[model samples]
Structures are given as C-alpha cells and as structure tokens.
Target chain A: MSFLFARDGHLLELGIDGLLAEELSAAERAELDQHLSTCAACQARVDEARALMAQPLPALASHTAETEEIKPPDLEQEWSAANNNRLWVATGVLLAVAAALLVVVLPSGSQPEAFTARGGELSLEVYRQTAGASQLLLDGDGAAPGDTLGFRVRLSEELHFALVGADSNDAVYAIWPPQGGSAAMGPMQAPEQLAAAIQLDATPGIERILAVACDAPFQLSDEQVLSISEAGDAPQVQEGCAQELVRLDKARP
Target chain B: MPPTLDIDQLYRRYGPLVLRRIRGFFRDPAEAEDVLQEVFVRVMESSDSFRGAARPSTWLYSVTTRHCLNRLRDAKRRRELLDEHGTAMGWGASAESAQQPAQLLIKQVWRELDPELLEMAVYYEVDGMSHGQIAELTGVSRRTVGNRLAQLAERAKDIGGGAR
Candidate 1:
C-alpha cells in the first residue's frame, strides 16, 4: 500500500517536509531532490507550501481597530412600541477622519454622532414576514420559530459588507452572501432589501447578527466570532469600516 | 509543565507543514485552504487542550489529518473527490496502478471505515508511519495501532472485492 505519487517508497509530503525543515539526511535529501526535479506535481506542491510559509502575518491594526461594546438590547420592549411601526434600525458610521483618530485614540470616542461632520453611514434593517406582510423587528426583539426574517441594508457610500450570525449554541454561520465572501454594494440613500431571507429554526435562544461594512472585502472567521462571543464584545473593524450588532431572542411559540 | 507556544508563532512555524498534509488529502486547493483555516480556528478555540501535548507538530498533524478525513467522509464531498481524482488512481494505467493500490483502496472504502480506523489508514498508508509512530501520536499501544490498520486493510479488501 503506497501513495499515488510515491517514488521508491518515499512519500512526497514527508520528503517535502524533511527537505524544508533540513531534517533529511544527505542521502535522503539527494534522493528527494532528484525525484522532485522529475515530478511536476510534487514540485508544485513544494512551491505552494514554501510560498505559504513565507507569507507574513496580517498587521494587528487590521484586526484591532474599532470593536463596539456589546450592549444588551432591551428584550422586554416590543418592536412597535420601540420604533413606532416595527422598524428596527441599527446604524454604523465610519469616517476616514475618525479612523485616523482611532490610530491614536481609543475606540470609545469614535461614535457615529461624534464623527457626523463627514463620513459614510451603514445601517441594517431587519423585517419579519407574516401573512404576506412584512414587519420590521427591533434589536433584542422576540422572534419565534418558523418566522421568516428579511434584511434591508442602507449604505451612504459604496463598500463591501458581510452579514454573520452567532447563535446561543455558539454556532457561527454566514447570513448574507450565503457562502462566505463579502458582497459589494453601491451607495443607496434608501434602504434596499436583500434577496435572501432567513427562516428561523426551532433552536431557541439569542441569535446575534453582526453586519460589517468595510472599504475592502473582508471575512470574519468563526474563531473571531467565537472569541468576540466569549468576550461578550462586538467585532472590531478597522478604519473606514463600520460594524453593527443586532441580537434577536428566539423562543418556542 | 509542558511548554506553551503562542498561536501566532505556531502558525508561522508549522502552518506550511499542516497545509501540505491537508493538500495531500483534499484535491481542491480552495477546500484545503478552508480546512486549514478551520484547523487553526479549532486550535485557537481549544488552546488549553494543546498545552500538555508532547510535541506541537504531532498534535497539529493529528488534528489536520482528522479534520481532512472527516471532511472527506461527507457523502457529497466524497463523490466529488472521487470524480476529481478517479483518473489519477489505480484504474488509470498499469504504471499508476502499481503505485496507487492504497489510494484506490482508500477511495473505495474510506466511507465505510470509522474515524479511528480511517486515521490509522492515513497514518500507515499515506504518511508511511509505522505502528509505533502512530501509537505514540495517538496515545495508543503499538499492538492496537497494528490491529486497527489490519482491520482497515481487511475492510478495504472486502469492499474492493465486492466492487469487482
């Protein structure tokens, strides 16, 4: 039993690792060098591995820029009572000037109001559909199982955005862009509903939705979401990026 | 106390080795990258469990192997993998057949084997590790590793025979 790419009982991966780590003996190195010269696939693999090894770690600023504190939404308040027509609006503002200030100052003073002199604002609107009619639900609103939830996003400027969700079970998954990548949206003064809607399962508890808007395409890994959840904090976006946290309590009907 | 290594340091030092091992199992480079990220994410999530490990490389290798095997065990993913790599496997040419028996066996019966046995097969047939090495990595006896691999070989034979 051997590998498809084995040469004289030498495994390609083992040989590559040994060669790269300088762990191979002289004879082993010579043998592997000869084999790699002849095998394009093995050589390509080694090249890719070497390239990956040489890649530099991302700068810390890209990760630690501006994380909002996780303020618990008031669950007892009805959406209609809160917004006066069942409209839940969570807005995030990122000013280039404010972002520059963030490099020196802490994130506390970087609120949307303080930087309103100039910048782009991103807002997320969540709506619950019932009997062919859509009603908006506020953050910390109670939603039951079998409820169909829709989303509409308003962006003051063109940006790449991603919607991610972390459930009470600690399961993190992508919401919008269904796959994992971010979607580019042009500036829209009015709210534009996304084509995709989420159907709530029977799982009960809080479902936290993180809407992130960044000047560049960015991805939030499950590790980051889990870390933020464990810390009970919001995701920290870099300068020229805005993030909004919306929490919905799901209960059994 | 076992030595502790920072997550970033670990990624810097051993990420290539882990990625190479993963790429060996998964044909799709994109899928391999996704799995690589997932493996590290799991490492970050459970860094406490990694504290007392004997060797960081062995731990990471085992983690990467198990992750790739679990992903390959998915019915849909398995179908796609077989379709992608089928030509390069044993059924292709006589020269390829001579070197691809283990790979063909794996592609044939990987779904039937349990997690433990599949891990043993990969360690033995793919990585070319001995029973002792696998036992040391898996914290099992050499005899146990031997027996599980024998069991895996037997299952592969049965599946291969029925397919013929």
Candidate 2:
C-alpha cells in the first residue's frame, strides 16, 4: 500500500484533524503524494506535529502523601491459630509483643531479664486430603539462630519417614523408627485422619513446625515430646507446648 | 562544616523538574504538589546518608521512582477495595520548566510516561547513565530496562506521530 507523505501540507491538515481514516479517496491520496515532493518545510512541520501527537493522553493526577500507608499488625499481638480444624487461641497481645521482640531484634547487653532468651512454641496438626497421605502445616511465632525444628512423616506400618532438613533445599533426610518398636509407621489413607507427632526437634535457626496427617483428630498438651524417625536415620525429637486438639474435614473433590 | 548539602537548596534547584515530572502522572495539580512535597520531606530525612553517591539528581530520580511505585501500588489496592478502575490524571498546563524551551519540552514530554519508563528514559537520556547503573539502582535486569525504554520511545512516537 502507498503511504501518505506526512510532509504533504494537504495530508498534514487531514492528519491533524484525525481525518486520515483507513482508506483515502484517490484525489486526496494523489494530493498528499504530490505535495510532499515540493515541501521540505512541510516535512519538518509534519515531524514536529507527529512528535507532539504521541504525547500520552492526560491522566488524573495522583497524590502520594494523601494515601494511607498500610502497616503490618502490631508486633506484639498473638495470631489466633485457626485452619483446617479446631481453633487454638494462644497468648494475647502482650505476649505477642514479647514474642516479636524475642524473635526479631539483635540481643543487646541491656536486654531485660524477661527478654533474655527467645523460644519457639511448637504445635502439630493433622489434615485429611482426599488423595494424599498427609500434609504438614507449619507456623511459628518467632525464630532465632541455633534453633532447629523438623516434621517426621511415617509412610508405612514399619514407621518409615521421608524427612526434610531445615535451610537446605532438596535434601530429604529420611529416617525409620527403630525396628519392632511400640509405634509403627503407617500409610496415611483416609480423609479426616490424624497425623501422629512423628518428631519435633529444635536446632539453631529453625522456626515452628505443624504436621497434619491425612485423616484423624489430634490433641495438644503440655506433657509430651513426639519422636519421628526415618529409615537409617537417628530419631529426631521436639519439645514445647503439646498438640492442641484439632479436626480435619475433607474439602470437596 | 563540610560544605553543607542543604536539601532545601537542592529542592530549590530541582523542585520544578520533579514537580513537572510528577505532574505528568496525575491529572490534578494539587496531587502533583502533594507528591512533590512528600519527595522533599523524604530527601531531607535521608540526606544525611547520601555521602556523595551518584549525582544528586540521579539519586533523586531513583528515590522519586520508588516513591511513585509505592503510591501506585497503594492506589491499586484502594481501587480494588472500592471496585473502581484506578486513574492517574495528568496536569501542569501553565507551569514552564526553568530549562531552555527545547529542553523543557523534552522534559515535559518525559512526564507523560509511566513512571517506570520515564525513569529509564531519564536515567539513559538525561542523567547519561549506562543501563547497568540503572539496573543496579532499580533492581531490574539491564535488558528489561532497555526494553522499557524502547517501548516508551515507540509510544512517544505514536503520540507525536501525527503531531508534525
């Protein structure tokens, strides 16, 4: 297709007025081509006009200071734990503040005796999946260096666990509970099933862990430490407040 | 006193350019002024740490770009909640840049761009920085910044395409 010469005075006029539709009459097209050959000044004007026309259409101006900045919730408030099952209300806002400071900030020489050390409160929950053995749900209030945590899943009645090491991606540090022990690793095969507290261990730099079995009800008490082991691996241990009672219902397929 | 790097003086020197740039983003002059004022306050607060980094104007551009992006995100969130299409109207028909007319026109046109593209253009065209410097400051790939500038040029051409 022949192009309209932007330098053609007649064409420039038509262009500026938004009259250059997809098709042009033969006479109008002829006029534009002929005008371009003789008019260098018109060519420059067309260029200038084209530049100006490319400017962005004006937009409504936005002001910055007037916009509200959204801040994260106060560092000191406990997040009520509620998920696939029962709701567990931990300490309130005051304790949340203690936890936040304990977890975040560098320790100072003048730190309060109450704030001398940081700790993680561990809990385990079991979830039921229609097509899977178990899903581990982990949450934490605070984490510090030298703190270690793990989720132990028993895949068989023989108590085989596929485990994962903290901070190292793609490493399955699996373990198996000692042979002929009181508890056996079992396949998770039902919805609303319970996940045993296979293991909870705290080493440095580990956060919190919550393991949900495929189907079952579970309980949290202050009295127990759960052991989780994988094949040919030493048993990993966890201690903190015990498992809170929880229930899992299958999500619609 | 180490030659005082008075933010106020810097403001006096560069405020008009920043205002005109910001004015390109919003259709309302009042809002543009508000963004300008916020920029000044932020410069003042952070000036102590500048320690003679890149040219002051380049640093200012980086700061303004981030500030504008954050504001844009916030605007998007508010619009989402209210279920309205967010708009940034343009302004500044009367204010003239202190630069010479041709330069002023270029600078004014610079405002009519998305802040991200405008930032790339200013860094490349005005500040004379290599794409690497821009990538480092903006935390984006150099190739991405280059692509943005190319797109910006095409859009600018289309708008001005019919002008001449």
Candidate 3:
C-alpha cells in the first residue's frame, strides 16, 4: 500500500540518501516528482545536488592516446628485478652469517689475503730448497704422483732469485736431455712470475715434486710461499706410455 | 536508427564534462588521463557495436564512468594500507574534497564509514548514473542502491550541519 506522509516529514528520509539519480520505481518516482513540484524544500535539495555536480574540475593535460605507447610494464623486467632483490637479500644474509662466524672462530690477527701490511714487514715464513733434492714438499701434505696442485709466493723486496722448497725422503725426479757444459744445473728464477715447474718421473706411488723459486736465497716479505691442494686428477698432456702406443698405432695406419 | 557517432567528434563536444566526471573519482592527473584514454580506446574498439543503444554522449558517459569507478574501487583498496599506516593520505589534493555533498560526507567519514554506502553515493551523484547502472555495478537491487544513496545523503547532511 502506498502511504503518503506529511510534506515536511517525507523529505527527512529522502535527505538521508540524497535522492537517487536513476532507476526509480513508478510509485517512488511519481512521489518524488510530485514532492518536487509542490514542496520547495525537496526542489532546493535536488538543485543543490545538481549545482555541486556542476562545479568545474581541473583540465586534463592534452595528449593524444592514439600515438602514445601506453603499454604495461615489462613482465621480464619485473621478474628480473624481483630475482635481483632476492639475490641481494640472500647475499646480505650470507655475508652477515659469515661475518658472525669470523668474529667467533677466526683469529683476531688474521687479515685478508689481499692485505699488504705496512711498516717493518718481515719474512715470517720461508720454504728452502737445495738444487739436488729428490723431492720437495710444497705443502703440509706432499704431492702424490697423480695429484694436482697450485702455488703462490710473495716477496717483501724484489729479488733476482730465491730457493723455495727442499728435497725430501719421498720425492720424484725427472731427467732431461743431457745439459750442455755451459747450461746451469738449476732453473732460472723469475720473481715476476712468482713460480717454477719441474715434472716428476711418471712412476707408481711416487711423490710429484715442484721446484719453485730456485736460483738463490733472496730476502722478501712475510708472504714467502703459499701452496694449496685442489681435488682433481693430474693432467696428462705430454708423451707417456699410453700416448706412445696410440701414436704407434696411428703411424701404422 | 541512431546514427553512429564519430567518437573523436563526440570527445571534442562533450569530453570536458566526461573528464570532469572521472576527475571526481580519481584524484591523480595521470590516473584521470589513463581513464580518459581507456574510454576512447573502448569506444574506438567497439565503434561497430554501439548500434544506437543510447545517445552517443550518454553511452560515452556511462562507459567512461564505469571505467573510472572500477579504477577508484581498486585504488581504494590499495590506499587502505597507506591510509592506516599513515603513509599516503589523499591523491595529491583532488581526492580531498568531494564534488558533491554526499561525496564530501565520504571524504570526511571514509575512515569509519561503510564502503558500500560510500560507493552508492559515488555511483549516484558523482557519476550521474542510473539506479540500474549502480545495481548492475554493485550486484544489488536498484531499490537497494537507491535506498542506500538516500540513506547516505541524509546522514551526510546531518553530519555536514553538525560540522558547520
């Protein structure tokens, strides 16, 4: 049933939700129109709503949508950025953990390998070698016949030559072509290269020896010699028994 | 048969009013520009489908208003965290003041007010959309949308008088 209330009281509910702009029921629409014509209060409220909508807003900047590239951001770039962020976060966490461990376990006096100590540098360590030794142990663990090794040496002062490793009980030696009367017995020392090489006799259970820094006793920095053991099979590029047999077979063909 | 409108010609004629409608919802100039561009893109893409359903200008307003409202709804969600966290307040300045009395109510009490009521007001007064349009957008009955808007306006006038 359609109920008609007093004119003053009718607009009370209408003001609550301002008048609806569209899709009015036939009855509600007729009632609103009838109220607007007869009651000035309802008409003023509608006028106010219309006036507010008429207020001007700022003008949009003139730009052609046709020519402008409004493409969305690149998905690949977004993924790459996310991955980079994760990588940096992971790296930062690892560095923090490593630093914490270093604080707890490493000696306070230890410095990075790249650090060059200033003032009164002394040679704290040295590896000594004589020319005729059978084998020289470069590290705490001697090299086996089939082991791969790497070596590094630093000098406090530039020198022409220095003997780095000595002959040990378990050593392997290689004999080369007979030395000419004028040729020196020991290898030439090159401090710039900071290393020397000597092939050992290819035999079972023999200790492969490297004679580095061999010409003379030279004074240098605390960084005298360094050697590290790596996990790998010995490289075999030169002529050996297996290579000889292959060469012989190829020659027959 | 209603003649097919050249959207560009219509834009030249009624673009200002339509832009103003969108400006009421989105505060950012860049976002308003995006909505305007979206309106034109949809019109251009669907030029053949208009098929004289409504006045070309009315259809443009309806389509453009719909796009702006959708953007505003999504933007409102994103701004919630910022608003609560005390980061970003309003979109520069445009989002501060409402274009209509009902919208002004929303801006002031939006923090404490119901979102559905606010959206009803926005769809009705700000966009000038029909109750059917609001119902379609909100998935509510036209009567419900009408009732909600009227109720919200009454509350706004009461609150506005108190502030005065």
Interface root-mean-square deviation (Å) of every model:
16.8, 20.9, 25.4
Ordering by TM-score: 1, 3, 2
lDDT of 1 by residue, A1-253 (tens): 1112342343445446655655566776777678777867567767766786676533222111111112343433321121111112212222111111111000000011000011236767665654423444544455665556656565777889887766555567666666666878757533454655555554556656677889999888887665554223566766678776666666412
Q: What local distance difference test score does each model get?
A: 0.55, 0.32, 0.33
Q: Write the per-residue lDDT of candidate 3 for residues A62-169, one digit (tens) a residue.
A: 223322322221222221111000000000111110121111010011001110111111111111212211111111222222111112122333322222221121
DockQ scores of the candidates:
0.04, 0.03, 0.02
Q: Model 3: per-residue lDDT, tens digit, B61-149?
A: 45665444333333233354235533222211112122344344555554443445555555454433556766755557989887877
Ranked by TM-score, the better of candidates 1 and 3 is 1
| Candidate 2 residue runs with Cα over 4 Å from true position | A1-253, B1-3, B76-133, B136-164
Question: For residues A1-253, could you state the per-residue lDDT of candidate 2 as single tens digits?
Answer: 1123221113322222221221445775566556656665545545544553444322211112112111111212211121211111111111110121111111101000000011121122221111212122212223322221112222212221221121111112211111211222243211111211222212212212222222222232212112211111122222221222111111100
Tell me which residue pairs clash in candidate 1. A67-A236
**Whole-structure CA lDDT of model 1:** 0.55
